[model samples]
Target: MRLRVEFTTEPFDLDEAPAHAVVAREVIQSADLDAVDVGPFGNTAEGHADAVLAAVDALLRDSLGAGATRISLQVNVVAEGHK
Candidate 1:
């Protein structure tokens, strides 16, 4: 299932930001799932559902670790036949 997910984590160390994105991309890729598109908007990622979810997990594990605080993650999945 494809979806569009927007999520953000607590402000991270400046140097670790790209690490976050990289980990996210890596997670999605590792999932061996479909990749329609992906990009960064502030701290959020906008793209495929499976990949985005994978990215979220990666970001949490890599950036925030187990102590990560909850922020806000919004997802707007384009309905089938709409995209």
Candidate 2:
């Protein structure tokens, strides 16, 4: 199964990236996922279910440990025909 995950770690910083945001980005970028898009307000990654789920686990743990007060996320199963 293919999965797509969209997430954000809160305690927003306009001047610079927060520690939690940085950690979240690092986790997603390093994970065995594809179609990763990282932005100031949000981030998304797509890959097989296992890879996406593993990344989600790491992202939550690392970002929270790095001082994220809140995290918003959504996971969806991508249809085979969809991109």
Give the winner by lDDT. 2
lDDT of 2 by residue, 1-83 (tens): 99999999999999999999999999999999888999998999999999999999999999999999999999999986556
- Give one digit per residue, the lDDT tens place, for model 1 in 2-63: 56655555545565545555554455455534433444543333455766676666656765
In order, what is each prediction's RMSD in angstroms? 4.3, 0.9
How much is the lDDT of residue 29 in candidate 1?
50
**Which residue runs does candidate 1 get wrong by more than 4 Å?**
12-48, 66-70, 81-83
**Which ten contiguous residues of candidate 1 have the minimum total lDDT?**
35-44
TM-score of model 1 relative to the true fold?
0.46
Quick one: best TM-score, which candidate? 2
- List candidate 2 stretches off by more than 4 Å: none
| Whole-model lDDT per candidate | 0.53, 0.95
